[model samples]
Target: MAITRRHLLQGGAVAAMAPALGLNTNVSAIGTAHAQSAPDGLKWRHGVSTFGDIKYPADFKRYDYVNPDAPKGGVVRMFELGTFDNFNLVVDGLKGSLADGVRLISETLTTRSLDEPSTAYGLLAEAAAYPDDFSYVIYRLRAAARWHDGKPVTSDDVIYSFEVMKKNSPMYSTYYQHIVKAEQVGDREIKFTFDGPGNRELPSIAGELPVLPKHWWEGNDPQGRKRDVTATTLEIPLGSGPYRVKEFVASRSVVLERVPDYWGKDVPVSVGKNNFEQIRYEFFRDDTVGREAFKGDQLDWFTERSGKQWSTAYDFPAVSDKRVIKEKFVNSSSGGMQGYAFNLRRPLFADVRLRRAFNFAYDWETSDRLLSNGEYHRDNSYFDGIAEFMATGLPEGAELKILESLRDKVPAELFTTPYKNPVGGNDDAARNNLREATRLLKEAGFETRDRKLVDAAGQPVSVEFLSQAQGDERSILFYKPYLERLGITVNIRTVDSVQYQNRLRSFDFDIVTTVWGQSLSPGNEQRDFFGSESADRPGSRNIPGIKNPAVDALIERIIFAKDRADLVASCKALDRVLLWNAYVVPQFAGGFQRAARWDRFSRPEPLPKYGVSGFPTLWWWDTAKAAKTGGRS
Candidate 1:
């Protein structure tokens, strides 16, 4: 799945707390449970969750994931996948890829802890509290919080940030849809009231909003021009984060420098993080060029996404001489689906049989072997893993109980058989699958005409597989023959990042290879992924343009889920429904961060459990290692 920071930023806003009611005990009674509860104030704890107790205590020192005294003096050069145009993340949204590490210029009220599943600690806000019903949440800003201009960060800034972003950014608007009002209630406190108290995730969602400096935009640039948050601009605005923009070459590179006297440097949450004194990001049009740059030492680090590349790409002199280090870091986190998504908006892919036929025509096993050296596994479920996100051995227990309500609406076959991808490791296996695909196409009002699949009106079935990466053409080419065998035309169109992103937002592609990042606890974001409302929204993650009532209902259940068991049941039911519909041709997925870097830095003893956020953020420059290898530091 496409695991962008945009996806990760949404993690903390949805509730992943302990269940007030026990598992299996709440599903039958959920129907009668009221959506809203009585109002009550909850004193601020160090962090928040759904069921389990907070990992950090009220007086905890710092997170265990980082080194409190890691020496930080190095220039860590990173690479961006595609080119970027706009530096504005809010207004540009889906139109531009935007500059990498842009979030360094802003701070959210609460930030996600890398090690935890669904928990957040205070950042700008020293304390955050909500009511039992979750009707409203209040945040008290830290007195020491100051903008780069040496001005105090205030409650007014918090309120203004919400109002502006909700109006300008479509993403923020959808994420903050449940929030009804934001106002300054006290000298340093801001209060946010919800549309109603019933939803359990409103408080956490409200905390995730990136607080913008009202004085910066509402006032003027150095030239005395009024600024608008919705307009894309190159002018660097004032920020209160740990770093500020040092220099930038439009669409090519952006460099950031640590603020030597930053106010929040010693804060508990900020300790041992943002260690690099100078961080740089250079842009490349594709991965091939980026890989070559890393090998030549033009770039400092590269993450190998292809299993085939990991197996064979690093046999260089630097690697053999031990000047470059290669390691596979374990990413023991929830995995989302990465597949060839069929656009439901297109009438050609609207039929379930037709979609299923497309899946049967392609051979994942052969593709996995040829393209990835058999290092990856064929992903079957939308939420694929050994975790709760995964659905194992069909629906049972609470999953069956939840799915029973939608028995009349979903596919009948789902009740009798577990979903599995069609097996095709060789020519004969592929032939059998295509024969079945041809039969299904015929049943779905399609027929072969001169060995080309034709519709009811005798028009040929053709689709363009839209992609941004130069590497994706190979994957598309791999499947093209299989599709051609079924009498369907496959057109591979590889565009630059900008045009590709615009195409995605406009719902212009027939088939696109996209990955949806799944969290251990699925919540509000599911609506943006599969809900009918988001199907038409421009920049929404609902890339397949799904508009099913069953999907919409299941997403609601997952969002307002009262307990862990209920969340699993809702997700499994949703996964089964999505799989039964055959929305996408499943692809391969791995649970590791395969990277190669010069041996000049060292990381904490153990990486974070939930993610591998990379070395630029937390790892420090190892002077001893640098001396041993004659590497840049």
Candidate 2:
């Protein structure tokens, strides 16, 4: 079955973002029997896909959703939540924020089409070639590709960028973990060889590698300090993308000017995108001030992430006079889980019984009404509302067959029972939930002593809910008391964005509110999000610290499934196990993106299928509308 935006409208957390990436293959490691290669040479193509065929053929012009002739002018001013002190995006200890358009200044080997479900067209690489089993793949770089300094991008630069990323960033290292090596095969060809055959997402993951400039990072900074790839620095890096850092004021603002002579400006994937003449990002300390800035004309676009604000806050005169536009765009994203994640690393939440108790104690119904104006729905599964991938009803058929293989290891009820969230909104239901929670805690070897839930060692069951913004705890405040009824101590920790990232990377909190963004085509990134290996790695998306061996096997199954049928079955099986285990107290997600923007810009008639909204990317300035309402004044 095809997943659509309508299904995602009911997704938990990923209802608002673009999501993908991969992990260790579970299929038996490459062995002698699978050592076959192509007869003559690899076949070259303009794009690549995992389960489906490439949507656009080799000779297609621009993507169907973009306007090839969309005029580009005017500035798009936006806001970033916190401060930035580093220009290095993939480095560790990158405590400060990086410029928003940093990636715009650099080009990836392949660029994805927003309208398609699973596709990535060649960007810097004119063509991609691979053998039958996908053991090795080669990219033919376009000779026309040049750096911001007019230097040709060479094979050495690609090799150097891959080597540095694998060495410096844990994410890139894991994402590209299966790629055994990268070697220059031809004058313009870069080949990435994998450890084995049959893992399909490897080629695309390699294609997503951001090709960095070897010369600039290897050179000295303006202050004459030796450049270090592992360390954070303020040196403006050179790029070959649509935008260049025009200027910047540290921790305050950044302005990027469009590159008139960008090497890939006319590339099929680049058409009608990055249309803004200039992109400005102003840093703000609070969401309230930032929203006010949009109303005050200090900013041009503001996407409302808060449901409360979306319901009652956009009643300003600008909206009344039609100077500001308030609308919701239905997204086609294959969403992932967002919820109060239990740090399974914490001793208090180690037991599945205790985790179930915590879930039972959460009053999502009352909290949704109080905090989100009842415009949200609680998440029921890790991959909730994600088309056919989500595990629902009772597991059967191929999903059951897969689960049968690990019957002894997984939860026995997973084979027979459907996962459901605890229900509670009023006092009577709340009391029933409390009683069930108490029963579950007792079964988990915890007891109520002095009205406090304690372990065998008499240590109180305490949880700290970590959030980047204090205002985000509106729902948490309602959840806190219910847990308290079960004699569980709850603490809500509010930290700045930078600090929150640091703490999350270190796995320093007991419980954190986080989301694992998903895409329609789920692949290797699932490993990073839930694989046992990622549980221990710092900076990984496995915030709940899952380390189940069954999960590791399931992830490999999802990554190596031969076709769409196999992929869907494996994913459904994985979702069931995760949901039954209860690693998170699933939160609510909005059906559509409640966005507020100035009336000065216009988007293409049809927006991209698998995205939140093509803002400041596919949307361009309307000169007539801008004249009536000042744009980026």
Candidate 3:
């Protein structure tokens, strides 16, 4: 059955109606596979589903529906990988994602809605105005907003955030490339003028800009700040967000305490949220102990690794009776691409036929069954929606130009007239592709001898799949059988997350599987992931080392797209080109989020557009009802 955005939005309503309507939507047993069923519930214990998270019972579960009219006081414990680094809030660092996630803890702006296309709305900025030239955008902050320490936030903070981040962080250059200058109009207003031709990406700016406290950072030039990082311990700066960092344990843990005087305490967006009286983020070495701790009620949430344990391991009668309510939030199909990335720098993989042969030999369905327990979906296109952009049809306008350009760069056989839109990966089709690959191998000075793929120098063709040690079991399992069939031995090497990151930074892998989630704006950064410049550079996300001029041009077209429709069409064309080249054997796209949480919280009649959890950051706890039910442990 085709899954739609409407179907995803109706998820909770459909789930609620199931029992009353006598429908058992037991997706537990997906397809022909039998999955373990949950027993009748006692009380659902609140928990998070994360890999290797520290276990703590103090995490609170606040529902969206039950607005507990209670005083604002509770610490929200979140699991952190490590200490707060200055580079996180900076735009130039590889660790910007986590920094962005952490910035929500201690910042505020004028607007309440972060989903708006204009960065004009947020807790700190009320409205943003853009000039006709797209040179800059001005943000007006609400005058009444105050930092947690009772200091008023002004334009200085905005400038400081941009300047400091641009000077120190690695990613700042990528996102803040259009900035011309930032001017403070008043204590409550700031104007950011852009210097380039680009649409106003408000959501990305709002999410990316972490409002820094100007008072604390005074006289700290961005250049000076970068050099003044000699101190081993730095005090947590004050901001007007809901949570504040209370303590840091270097490598093991970090704890955040709820701010009693949070500015938006009464706002509906924040009310009855950040429920836990104290949030203790404990870091562990591995998933085995994390699961054990969760089973023993020592942890509140475990994001990943719940699949295998929840299905096969955690079936103890005592644990099963609690009736763990599963929640699945589906949004528009991900803008990010997930697949087996090829190293285009490698000669054998450069040939489209060879790449397609590997993709054809691999049975994604079987691999998914073995790896994800049949709880997955195949990726049809890089853009996974049926929106006009994802809609299947002829590529026109700029898309046509892109396709035409890539025609020769990609294999002629793959994009021939009979199969302009050929669905890749079939056994017979794979054998045909293999035969073609063998021919290409010969052309590239390699020949198959006795079914073995080898170079003219008699060196065996092999590729190593490198991934983060603990989190990449699915990728490892999926490609193992396929590579073997092509007589190309694939070596799967699991390394520590830190090591894996280091290797990616150094471009030291033949093949790798990485999860790429799309930003809300979904702009130029999308193309940069696979662009030639990115492929050759250190610390770039383009691990494939692809350098084709046609691919680069297509990526550029996708970025200059004027609207969502144009963007989608351009992206589809680029996706087709990539697929034809067999640059990456597309893996299963993200399906439903397999998560279990205690039933302490409920949503109002109309959940927000993104569903129960407000866009990633704005989750709260209904303390009054939670207390009545049984307050924080």
TM-score of each: 0.93, 0.93, 0.75
In candidate 3, what are the lDDT values of residues 304-361, reduced to their tens digit?
4334444665665434555334455554333344677877776767666666566655
The CA-based lDDT of model 3 is what? 0.50
The digit string of per-residue lDDT tens for model 1 on 1-633 reads 112243221111221221122223222110111123222434554465543444676566788989999997888888677777776657645556667777787888887666655567788987777766768888778899999989999998999889987777756766777788999877887889998766776776687888888888787877888887777777776789999989889878889998988888888889998888888988887778889999988888887777788888889999998989888876555567778999899899889999999999989889989999998888888877535656666788888888888888888888789888999999999999999999999999999989888999999999999988787788889999999988898899988877887898888898888677676656777877788888888888888989888888898898778766677788889999999999899987776668888888988878777656446777998889888777675
- Each model's number of backbone clashes? 13, 4, 46
The ten-residue window of minimal lDDT in model 1 covers 25-34
In order, what is each prediction's RMSD in angstroms? Answer: 4.6, 5.0, 12.6
Name the regions of candidate 3 deviating beyond 4 angstroms: 1-87, 91-101, 108-120, 147-149, 197-207, 214-238, 266-273, 305-310, 345-348, 391-398, 401-444, 449-452, 474-478, 519-521, 599-606, 611-632
Q: Please, what are the lDDT tens digits per residue for candidate 2 over residues 555-620?
A: 899888887678879988998899888898888876466778889888888788765577878888
- Arrange candidates, best lDDT first: 1, 2, 3
User: What does the lDDT come to for candidate 1?
Assistant: 0.77
